[model samples]
Target: MKLLERILKYQIVTSLCVLTLGAVLFYFSVDYLIDREVNKELMRSKAKVSWQLRHINELPVYILQLGDSLQLDQVRYPGQMALVERKLFNEFENEYQPYRQLIFYERVEGAWYRVTISKLLAQRQQLLEAVVMTVTFIVALLLISLLLLNSWLSRRLWRPFYKTLRALDSYQVEKHEVLTFPKQHTVEFEQLNQSVTHFTDRLAATYQNLKEFTENASHEIQTPLAVILSKIEGLFQDESLKESQLVALSEISEAANRLAKLNQALLLLTKIENRQFLAGTEPISLVPIINRKLRDLEDLIEQRGITVKTAIEPTGPVMHPALAEVLVNNLLTNAIRYNVNGGTIDIALNAGKLVVRNTGAPIHIDPELMFERFRKEGTHSASLGLGLALAKTICQVNGQTLTYETDGPWHILTVTW
Candidate 1:
């Protein structure tokens, strides 16, 4: 059976058992109470007869006539009248009361004298029947109420969860739409709805990003490889001039370099997107890291006449030193590559914030567009525009924020923890 039906059945069975036990106990109790009342009335009548016999000296003959009219039998003395017919007698007779036998023989002359008294058992069968009927009616009403209540409660409790399940079932990966869950009043259901919504959204985003990355990587890799193959074929066909062959060989080498860079970019993006950089965290002094990267790029920095400045704090225990290194290297490279002749690159790290500002001509391209892969802002072949994007991905994975803003003659790249 379904869950609701099973719950209803269990509840109904339990309620019925309780009601049945109560009815049985009520039936017995009612029977006992009625029997006691009836016995009291019968004993009262017997007491009146005993009282009349004790005051026999002042009794009239009409008292005997009265006893006949009342269907009561009398004996010679009070003790003799106690046990007349002895019907339905008690197993243990009362010790304080003495019994006497009185026979009600046929009437003689006008006297009509012989006597026998019979005690009747109390009428409890009708009382038991009434109690059963009353309790049955009450139980029926209670069962109806319980069923209605159970149904209402079940619907209210399961409504949100049902909606969540339906949403999940209808989710489409290709569509890439956000799944929304209904709000719930119950705490557990509300929490469940929130968790499901979060999980589905994350899954959809990851799937879409991976799909786009695959498509872009294929296109990027194929174009250059095709150009290189075509150039080599063309060079083989031209056997007339050595200079033409040399130029073709140079073109082929350049194409190969471009292809290699494309592959490396694709691999690096995949690694960042796949969260492969999250190994362990350690204390990394930003000053040393920046100085090392600058030293490595000293030739390029000097050739460009870019004056670099740094102010870093001695912070401990930053997240994922490898990722941090990648982020810093990418930002510094972008700043230096885009800087003007004799430009200035200011790098600062204090507390948990790091800012890399470069003095150059105002960036004509939108800063937002610069973070997209293969989107170069100007005629700079050295920049494939994947560096900033990679840095952004690393920051996102490590729970940091990277933002870009320009002030007057300087473009600022800020990373905050």
Candidate 2:
């Protein structure tokens, strides 16, 4: 499901479940309350009937002397005849004691007369109607409140996420575009916005670098090819034997070699930039890699009469052996390439910091531009100029920082964790 739809679906289901539970509970509670009130009214009526039956003698005297002359027993009442057919004797019975129904049987001039005194019971149909009405009213009011509350809560909770979703829909990566989401009141949504912003920024940077790399590679390759073609065409124009022509051929060959090297370097940089070298993690030691790279460049260092020093600390372990090797190799190559013929190279490693210093001419290029692709400093312009750039990319992928500085005649490079 789409993210917003999923969120809304869960919210709605939860609200409905809660509302249903509340309604069931309310139904039982109201039923109990109404039942208690009806019972109380019935008890009050029974008490009145009991009081009149306790004074039966006075009741008969009052009933006879009332000027109306029609006695309660002499009249053939509908309810009275029904009670008589049931053989309802006029006597106080234990079964009626609880509800206070009293029946008095008396001999008045040798004729039997029965008097029934009982509280009127409510009809079963009336009780059923009352329960139905009360429950209907309560349920109606509860449902209305539940709907209103559900709407208000759902709108309030999902408002920010909806805005974020809309912003993401309109985002375009090709245009180097991003939509900034507002800070959400909820912690989870705020964290989501931060992660998305970081991802987009990195994507834009990688895309720009790829574009520049393609353009630079095309131009570098074309330049050497054009030179080789022109030299070949000039050689065909005249079958001449001259030292200058031989030198021109050698120069063309060297240019072709340089172009090939540049292509290989560019490919390697692309692979590293895309993080294709990330295999499974393995423990690696930095000292051995650094020492190995320095030894590989020993011949050049000795021929130039440069002094080399090392102060590597024994590290416990590290992940990504190949990455460490690449980083150390690139830094060492750059240091050797840019140093003076009879200068010094100093390498130090201690407390998670690696410092490489070389005695060289002061750099005239911008330090900020030094780590950029195709950027070259003075007198070392023949180099491919991507060694330090590759080193920087390696540091970034491995969660390290590569910084450069100039101290007098020494150029210092530092890598820190």
Candidate 3:
């Protein structure tokens, strides 16, 4: 959930709990006050009844019918005075209603009697209604205030934070730009802004230093490799050199050439990862590129006695044209390099995807492991093992997916956008 949503959820829950508790306490308090008033009225009625019983000769039964219930019962002895609350049946309403009773013993002309005075506790409903109204009013106010607070927070308080986030989202290390923000009133937001600015500043500096170092190292290493290869080539032309020495020199030349290629491949991989090549917005057609690569590699395919089949459409993914060429070349070469004699290579290109399935010796390990650079199937093989790694990197940087799967002798490499 969003941060504001989480906060709102907890606030509402706590407010409701508090409101419920307050309503409960308010209900009981109102009920208590109503009972107190009712009990007082019952006591007054008991006093009048006691006085009337003492003057029984002048008091008439009809005078006691003024809303209060009065009862008298002659007893052998006067018992203790008592007060109680109970629900009593009312004949007029044909239902039970709440009443408070005050009972006292009275002696009238030497005859003992018990007098009970009852009063209805009618304010209980009003207490309930009052509590309900108060709770509802509180709840309504809380809801309105919370909504207003949330709106104000989102628009005003969180504005600078979101702006800082947008700046960070589009940040690019290659641009070597340091991030700075306008002053913020909120301390936490200011701290966040400062931290982000510092982080981006450090990131840009580090990336620039690394880029320069990589360029310098690649240049420095390439000159020596070229010299070594050229010197070995010159030694090969010397007829005075022994056969064993020439063989050793040839091996050294091959190793040097492979090392140079590996270095270039690694540099290219690093550049792709560093976002040096950005893809175009529109997808470019792979038909022409695929046809061109096949034509160029026709001799290699024929030499290996490999049969090539293609089911292609004029469709491809959005990517840099140079990277597209490299991606296709690697997939095709990888298929050819690993194929058995007279093996079959199947190429299919559709609107959204490209599939290259080649018949090779069944690999015992997972096909996904081949994407790791320098991971080779054979220990003594001449292959540099960077081809699939480079292809995978290109697809990744260009927002495409490259997957490897195997079925018996057919190894499938798929790229999807």
What are the per-residue Cα lDDT tens digits for candidate 1 across 1-417?
877789989998998998889878887788778767654544554445445544542323343321122244434433323434233433444322222233333232333444343343323455667778888998899889988999899988877777888888887655666777666778998898788778878988987888778768777787877777677777767778598677868777676777767777777777677655554565567777788899999999999999988877876235677776777789999999989999999988888789999987777767877777777767787676689888888877777788988899998999887
Model 1, residue 228: distance off in Å is 8.2
Best by lDDT: 3
List clash counts for every candidate, in order: 2, 3, 0
Per-residue alpha-carbon lDDT of candidate 2 for residues 1-417, written as tens digits (9 for 90 to 100): 965456556766775677667766776666666556545543443344335545453343333211111122522222322121122223334232122233444334444445544432223335656766766676667666766676678678878877777877877555676566778889998988888888778877877777677668767787777777677667756757588877777677667767767777787777666655654354456888887887898898888888888988876134367678878988888888889999899999887788999999887866768999988787564688888998898788767788999989999999887
- The residue ranges of model 3 lying beyond 4 angstroms of the native Cα positions read 40-67, 77-86, 89-95
lDDT of 1: 0.71
The C-alpha lDDT values of all candidates are 0.71, 0.68, 0.85
Report model 3's TM-score to 2 decimal places.
0.89
Better of 1 and 3 by TM-score: 3
Q: Which ten residues in a row have the lowest lDDT in candidate 1?
A: 94-103
Worst 10 residues of 2 by lDDT: 63-72
Return model 2's CA RMSD, one decimal: 16.7
